[model samples]
Each structure stands twice: as structure tokens, then as C-alpha cells.
Target: MLLEGKTVLITGASQGIGRAAAVECARAAANVAINYLGDEAEAESVVAEIRSLGREAIAIRSDVADPASAPAFVAAAVTAFGGVDVFVSNAGICPFHAFLDMPVAVLDRTMRVNLHGAYYMVQAAANQMVAQGRGGSIVAVSSISALVGGEYQTHYTPTKAGVHSLMQSCAIALGRHGIRCNSVLPGTIQTAINKDDLADPEKRARMAARIPLGRLGVPEDLAGPILFLASDMARYVTGAALLVDGGAFVNLQ
Candidate 1:
């Protein structure tokens, strides 16, 4: 029960890494607030699973890209759970497109969801945490693409990089309030967004070969690190960019 009596709000929590984190936090005895953009059923399913663990859970529908919705959702979660102990900014979009093929619309949409959305959520969460005077943890879900260029992710990578920067800045600014801010950079993970890309035998093989770990990551693989960052274990940690990349970044080939 690392997070006993704590309340955690996770965005994009309907499935994938966000969902896994929600379940893990609940198992640690934290009340969970699952936020989803569109999948009501999936969000509710996560809520049900958390409740089965004897932890309180709620499903919140919010589009992080919407500035108004970001604060609104955080406020709603506070109302539901008393106050937020952890806020995981995991909502993001990564549509691959070659640099030459990238369009303005795609770049705008990507920034809206990945960059602006994260900024708004962090601001709102920090404000609430400061107001509570209890301090809190904010974990932004970044990607290894932020550190290395992705041939097909010219626009996508920038958003993640921006998120990492945001985390650092937030960490420095929120430290005085006892708040900790950090970023988690995940490597290739088996999520619905990349299902088709990884389904290709050749693509999967090439990707696995590049990773020193010899396998792609699963959503659960990141849950533990995220939980640690959000827990008291990381009391002295802040402004850190942790790579849960399974040695992908170290594999130079």
C-alpha cells in the first residue's frame, strides 16, 4: 500500500499505459480517477476493475486539448476524491508521418493534444496541489522519441520533447510548494496506437533487434516506475527525466 489514502488522476486512462498505471495505483490503495477522451465503455471498465480492488474509482470524460476542459476535469476530480495526490499527464497522440509528408493540420493537432494539453493539466494540477498545501507529484508521459529523432515522427517527437521541458520547469517552480514533477520516457510499447505498426512481422523483428532487451515493452512495464515516482519513495526526486526504454536508447546501430 505505497499510496494508501492517496487519490490519483490519470489522463488517457481508458487503456494502454494509463490504464495499467491506474490499476497499479489502485492496488497500492489509492483512489483512482480515470480520464478518457471518447471511450466511455473502456473508461468505465477501468473504473469497475479498480472498484473490484476495493478502491474508489471514477471515470471522467475530458479532452485535454481543450483548455477549459483541462481545469474543469481536475476540479471535478478534486470534488470527487477530496484532493489529488498524484496527477499523471498521460494523454497524448502520436501519428507517424514522414517529415516531407507532414501537414500543418497534423502538426497543429499533435501540438494541441500533446503539448498544450499537458501544459494545461500541469498548471491546473499544480494550482490545486498548492492550494491544498499537502504537496503532490506530477508525472508527464514523454517518449524516447524526445531524445532521439524518429524518421516518421518529426512532429510527434517535438511534442514529447516539449513535455519533457515542461516537466523540468514545473519541477523547479513547484519544488518550493513541496510538489515534485518528473517525466517518464517510454520506448516502444505494445499499445493500441501502435498495434498495426508492430503487427508487421518484419517491422517487429527489426524493432526487437534494435532493442538491447530483445523485446518491446508492455504497458505494465512502465506502471512500476510511474508508481515509484508518484509515491513517497521519490520524495527527494524532482525535475528528472526517467527513461523506461528497455535499453533502446543505448542500442546504437
Candidate 2:
């Protein structure tokens, strides 16, 4: 019960990595507020699962990129669960295409949701955490793309890189207030985000070959690290960029 009695707000909790984190948080005995942009049904389903875990849970619909909506989302969660002990900014978009071929609108949307949304969510949640006077944790989900650029993923990389920077910035700015901020950079996790490619045996094999660990990561594989960062176990750890990539980042033979 690392997070017993904790209340958490996780953005993009309808599916993929965000959804996985929501369930994991609930299993850790944390009441969860699940946020989704457009998939209400999916969000509700996740909420059901959380409730089944015997923890309080709710589904919130919000566009994290919308500054005005973000605070409201947090307020709603706090109203439901008393207060937020942890906030996980996991909402993101990946419009795959070559940088040179990317449309302005697509790029703008990506930035707004992936980078800007995170900032707004953090602000809204941090304001409450600071007022609580007990301090809290902020765990953001970044990606290894932030470390190593990928082909046709220029826009995605910048946003993920921004997350790493955001985590460090938040930790430094909020440390005096007892708030801890850290990020997890996952590599090649098998999620809906890459269903098309991963579904192809050849493509999957090719991708796995690049990872030093010899296997692709699963969403559950990330839950432990994220929970640890948000738990008392990581009290002294902040402003850190942890790579849950199973040695994928290491190229040493």
C-alpha cells in the first residue's frame, strides 16, 4: 500500500499508458480521478475498474490543452476526493509524419496538448498541493524519444523533451514547499499508440532487435516505476528523469 489513502489525478487515462497507470494507482490503494479528452465511454470503463478495486474513482472529461478547463478538472477531483496527493500528466498526441511534411495545424495541436497541457495541469494541481501545506508528488510521463530523436517523430520528441524539462523545473520550484516532481521516460512500450506497427511481426521484430533488453516493454512494466516515484520510497528523489527502457537507451555492446 505504497499510496494508501492517496488521491491522484491522471490525464489521458482513457487508454494506453495512461489507462494502465490509473489501474495501477488504484491497486496501490489510491483514489483516482481519470481524465479523458474525447472518449467518455472508455474513461468510464476505467473508472469502473478503479471502483472495483474498492477505491473511490471518477471520470473527468477535459481537454488538457485548454487552460481554462485544466483547473476545473483538478477542482472537480479535489471536490470528489478531498485533495490530490499526486497528479500525473499523461495526455499526449502523436500524429506520425515527416517533419517536412507535417501540417501546421497538426504540429500546433500536438504542442498544445502534449507540452502546453502538461504545464497547465501542473499549475492547477500544484496550486492545490501548495495550499494543502503537506506537500505532494507530480509524476509526468515522458518518453525516450525525448532523449533520442526518431524519424518522422520530430514534433513528438520536442514535447516529450519538454516533459523532462518540466519535471526538473517543477521539482526545483516546488521543493521548498514539500512537493516532489519527477518524470519517467519509457521506451517502445506496447500500447495502442503503435498498434499498427507492432501488429506486424516483421516490424515488431525489427524494433525489438534495437533494444538491448531483447524485448519490447509493456504498459504494466511502467506502473511500478511511476508508483515508486509517487510513493514515500522516492521521498528524496526529485528533479529526476528515470528511463524505464530496459537498457534500450544503452548502445554499449
Candidate 3:
């Protein structure tokens, strides 16, 4: 009930963390605008789920990686819900690859989608919030990889670090307008992004064994943290990074 009557715009809501967060926010009574570039049917399902909660919901097809799409994405939300009250920059992709022979195409695309996408979306949302003169919240989904390195994720980690850093800078720049900016660093969530890697039961078990929680995270695990950051409860909280990793980050030796 924290975001009752608010308008929440989320990117990459077709699946995973974004989808979970969108549905959770709607459960809290917020109208939601979902952005997705893949699988129209998947996006529609999320919309249907949110609608079932009796909240206004719209599915917008937008690619955050495209610079021009950011403004358009926010505009679509504004058109549907009047104005943006909460913006979640959750669109990202991670292609597992070794550092030694990482292809330029993989690195460039990852940077564009994960890092640049957040930048564009956040800026667009902040501008809208500033114009509205009522302030708002922007939550970026960074990753635990931002704090730790990965042997096979050479090209992916930096973008996530950049997303976290972007939230820090945006917090300072938008603080005057009362716009709160924060980042959520999630750990090893079982999503389509890493379905291939986690498919091996032994590997997943080994990874889970290292976590203090004795399990890998799921998309729903991040929904609450994201909702908190977007709601009024975090009014005084900005320029912060909250780890939704189930104690995994601290458990590291």
C-alpha cells in the first residue's frame, strides 16, 4: 500500500525482476506502465496480471538501449498514467563470456543496454519529475557484480557498476528537485538471462552453497526492495545502494 495511486514506469518488465516488481507495485495499488522489447505476448501477460490486481496497466514496447526510445518510453507512460511518479530502470542483458577473448560486439552491446539504457531512462524520468514539480523516485537495478568481479562476465560487470554510479550522480543532480535516486544490487537471480548457466544443477548447487541464505535469488526477491525505494517510506533515502542479495554480499570471505 506504499505506492497507492502512484504511477510506476518500469523497463524490461516482460520477465524477471522487472515483471516481479511491476506486479508487486500494482499490488501496492500503483498504476503501472511496462516497457519491453522482446516477446509482446510476455509483456502482455504482465499487463494482464497487473490488471487483475485492479490497477491501471499498460504494456509499452520500447528499447531502452536506443537513445531516442527513452523519452518516448516515458512519454508513453505519461500519456497513459498522466505523469511519472516512480521510475524503475530495470532493463539489462548479460552475455557470459571469458575476458581473454571477449568480442567487441558483445562488450559494446552490453554497455549500451545495461549502462547506457539506465542513463537515458533515468535522465528522461528525472526531467519529467522535475517538470511535474512534485518530485519522484528513480530506482536502477544494478547487480552484485558491480561490487565483485566475475571470471566469465568480463564485459558485464562494468556496465552494472556504471548503473550504480549513475544513480549516485543522479541523486546529487536531482536532489534539489526532491527526486530520490537509488540503486538495487541483486545477486545471482534465477532468470532467463542466466538460464543456460544455471541449468547445470551441480553448478547452481555450488553457487547456492556459497550463499549464506543457502539458495540463489529469484526475481521476486528484488520486488520488495525496489518497491521500498519507490515508495514514500524512502523519502529521506537517496544516493544509496541496497543489496537485495539475501546476505550473499556480506558472506563473501
For model 1 the TM-score comes to: 0.98
Compose the digit string of candidate 2's lDDT tens values, residues 128-191: 9999999999999999998998888888999999999999999999999999999999999988
lDDT of candidate 1 at residue 79, scale 0 to 100: 88
> In model 1, what is the error at residue 44, expressed in angstroms?
0.7
What is the Cα-based lDDT of residue 110 in candidate 3?
A: 93
For candidate 3, lDDT tens digit of each residue in 98-158? 9989999999999999998889989999999999999999999999999999999989999
Clashes of 2: 0
* TM-scores for every predicted model: 0.98, 0.97, 0.98
User: Compared to the true structure, candidate 3 yields what TM-score?
Assistant: 0.98
Candidate 1 lDDT by residue in tens digits, 43-100: 9999999999999999989789999987888888888989989999999888778898
Count of clashes, each model: 0, 0, 0
Task: Identify the candidate with maximal lDDT.
Answer: 3
Clashing pairs in 3: none
Alpha-carbon lDDT, every model: 0.93, 0.91, 0.94
